[model samples]
Target: MKRIWNNSWLQKGLRNSTFMQSKSPHQIDPELSDKLFSIVNDILPPDKQVKPRTGLLTFGDAPFHISQPNQHDTKAEFEHEYQIVTEAMAGLRKLVPLFLTREDADQQRTLDLLRLEFDAKMQQGAPETPIDVAIDLVRSVVADVGGLRASVRIFIDLFRALSERRDELEQQRDKFWNLPHRAPEYYARAIANRLAKLYARKTGQKPTSGASTDTGDASTKFTKALEQIFSLLDIQSGARPPADWAIKNLTEEDLAPRMSVLENLGLGPSPSRKGLSMSRCVLPEGPKD
Candidate 1:
């Protein structure tokens, strides 16, 4: 029988097979995968991590399954499908935060699994990102319940409480950009959304606090937002001095920078400057365009 080489919307994703082949699960040291899974598994809710037959977040239409009678099955196809299945689980890692936030017994185990998958996907180059998607979905799911504010606040929680981790997330975005069609907008939109949450977390009426005033380890979403807002504004004003966040409030325009690229990625501090710095590589849309 002749093989049919048909393409689907997922074909673009399939093109990302190079990402999957690089880190086949069997290649992962069994001891390490076990140890890591054990640690994260210990902290998560029992039965939550189990890949259920169905759920709110399922691979409903994700073309990870392809059964063909005409074609000979090869390792490449098998590996690609495996990559799709594994890559799609990217969001479950963020369940680590859910479990950790609740201090579940299996928090350690869940976190370990998350770390292992996050690292493996990154190293393998597949960029199977469930964390990013999960957060976005959470926002979507919450929006109906809390309206835009809930969505906005969750974003704030992500940006400010975790702004220090922005560097790592940006690196993942850079990796994803190298994939098919090169979704630079994916990075920008994600960053902007997070920034918006960071902004709303700050200056907005709502409040969430971590750490103690007595300990002087206070971390309010406000501080992170201000820093990011100033950086974004600086990007817009052609590298103006970072605004004195000491002042009262900031507007969206105040946060808008020229193209607003820096905060979109690399808001994490760098040695090149006291504040954010770009990764220093020309994207596809360089000056030649």
Candidate 2:
């Protein structure tokens, strides 16, 4: 966050700076200043850049000498510009995680923290999370400077950039998912443990005797754990049945539509009919008993 300075402190700082020491009021070369301004303007986003305006007068469609504001107005304008710069810097700092490389530990930690914060907000039934608030603040800042049209243009540009980088973004997402804690088996084990606790609370009975072994194949262990959970819940009928019944009754034809729905929602990969099967694609294969 930027520190707020009183008018006296700002005046003191200016007095100490070279800007105040210059003998001539216009010590800086106007052409050089204009060139530097143009360079910086070109580098800045459209929403942040200063727009050129017509001078006080024009001759043959060309701008004449530009008019300068009063000293008080110029001071206020400079303070406003300084405030905008500081706020933009603060916002960029908060968004550092988004720009970091996938392998950066800081990026991972920041993302985990954000996810936890988002989950906490959701659990607390918050109307707006911190992320949402930050986004709205940025939109408001852009709109304040360049109006609603600029905000829309900024979002449209962002969407285009994301669309162009979809494949790279997917690869980064896949990398994140491949992390140890994000493994499928890890989630399955977590779900099983939670369900076991819930079952104990509901039935007032201890969980099954033999817990799923960690040494065996992960898929086998996951399957066994799921079986134990289903047994505990006594779900012996309806759409969710035992593995044997599922293998016999459910086919690619039956699951294809659901897979298509997932694909459409961008939750799963594109559904492939050729390699689709109950055991391979839909369910974990293990001993039936």
Model 2 lDDT tens row, 1-289? 2232357875465456533233444233445345434533442345544333433211111011111111223435545644554444344323422422234567667755765554443333322224233333443354345443343334334433333234333333353333543333322233344333333333344333233257532233223444544333343322112222323433333333233422332223433543222122221111134
- TM-scores for the candidates: 0.17, 0.18
**What's the CA RMSD of model 2 in angstroms?**
30.1
Report the C-alpha lDDT of model 1 over 160-241, residue by residue, as the tens digit.
Answer: 3343233333444354433454443333333333433333333343223343457533244433432333343232321111
All candidates: CA RMSD (Å): 23.5, 30.1
Candidate 2 least-lDDT 10 residues: 58-67
TM-score of candidate 1 relative to the true fold: 0.17
What ranges in model 2 sit over 4 Å off? 1-72, 98-101, 105-110, 122-125, 128-289
In order, candidate lDDTs are 0.34, 0.35
